[model samples]
Target: MDKTTIICRCEEISYEEVEEVIEHGGRTFDDVKRLTRCGMGPCQAKICTGLVANIIHEHTALPLSEIPLQRMRMPLSPIKLEILATNSTAFSAVKSVLDEVEIEDGKVR
Candidate 1:
């Protein structure tokens, strides 16, 4: 593959950048991501995840099965903290839940 070829258009990540991360002790997809920001784009890795995985496999010779899946996070959209704090209904709902879930000795009580 061309070193200049763009793998993640959203983040402007290239094949060479991914390989660089791998050469610098990036053995997993998450490692490459944290190092190169390859999969942390607007698309949320929907496009470049497979490509990154392939690169990792090619560089490290690790089996595809050993490659850990990317962590699935909640709130796909960026939430505005100001809006969440100012919204009385949402705040009250979260506060009520927290109030009920009492923590004792690092366990919910």
Candidate 2:
């Protein structure tokens, strides 16, 4: 295996590491991402989402659709609470936009 297979280029994960996670019963995209950090990069899985899905599917019996993609709507990655607190303007804008929306029994409409 190449020392640098570039699984998650933003996070510097390797392909071998992701495969190892799949080999160890990682049947879902989230499972693999959590265990191997493949889809949790700066590109926010846009760069490696399909690839990671294929890798996990190749090692498991589950179908591709069964594994839901990670949340990609907004605020993509984990940000510190403090950081979020500091970005009041951006947070307020996002909050206002989100607040204007309504959810009817879990369905956005």
User: Which candidate has the highest TM-score of all?
Assistant: 1
- Tens digits of per-residue lDDT, candidate 2, 1-109, equal 4636776788888778888877787776677778767666667787887877776776675688887776565566667778877848666666444775899999987
lDDT of 1 by residue, 1-66 (tens): 999999988899999999998889887778878887887877888888888888889888999898
- TM-scores vs. true structure, each candidate: 0.71, 0.60
Q: What would the C-alpha RMSD of candidate 2 be, to one decimal place?
A: 6.1
State each model's CA lDDT, in order.
0.81, 0.73
Instruction: For candidate 2, give the lDDT.
Output: 0.73
- Residue ranges of candidate 1 with Cα displaced over 4 Å: 77-109
Model 2 scores worst on lDDT over the 10 consecutive residues at 89-98
